[model samples]
Target: MGLADALAEWTDVDGAQYELGRATGLFADRTFLQVKWVLWSSNPLGQALYDMLHALVRAGVLEYRDEPDHQFRWRTAAPIDGLDG
Candidate 1:
């Protein structure tokens, strides 16, 4: 699989990917976390997940998934309505 897909599978319930996919409807959403917090946090997996999410977004494979309650990061479904491109 591609790198972004690989990272999405690696994420957890609060994983940026999971959150992003959940916010697919969009209301001007974004996902941001303090890098310092991640650096200090004891969870290596959390940091890795965040890093992966950011990278995926930067690579243009995904975007900031927004909402009223929380922001998420997710890849957009292609515009083709599941038709093969």
Candidate 2:
């Protein structure tokens, strides 16, 4: 799923996810390079974005998919225990 769609459908804080995706252009561009640049940049927003995604993964709401070419991707996993979606 797209970042915004996954964020909206699966996350508890949809507004924050959408805002973060907009701020980082992650919603508009899902390329590995874009993600790498954002995460590696000096911007504090990058860290916050990374932290939130990490937490989602830990909570089993998302999962990482590593491509053969080393692309980093995230997709919605199984729904969590309490969330309806």
Encode model 1's per-residue lDDT on 25-79: one tens digit a residue. 2212433342334334667745655566666557665555444322333355543
lDDT per residue, candidate 2, 2-85, as tens digits?
A: 454545433333333444576456657454444555555667766677577667666665553334321222443446565543
Query: What TM-score would each prediction reach against the true structure?
Result: 0.37, 0.43
Q: Ten-residue segment with the worst summed lDDT in candidate 2? A: 64-73
lDDT of each: 0.44, 0.51
**Number of backbone-clashing residue pairs for each candidate, in the order shown:** 1, 0
Give stretches of model 1 more than 4 Å off: 1-41, 65-70, 77-85
lDDT of 1 at 19: 46
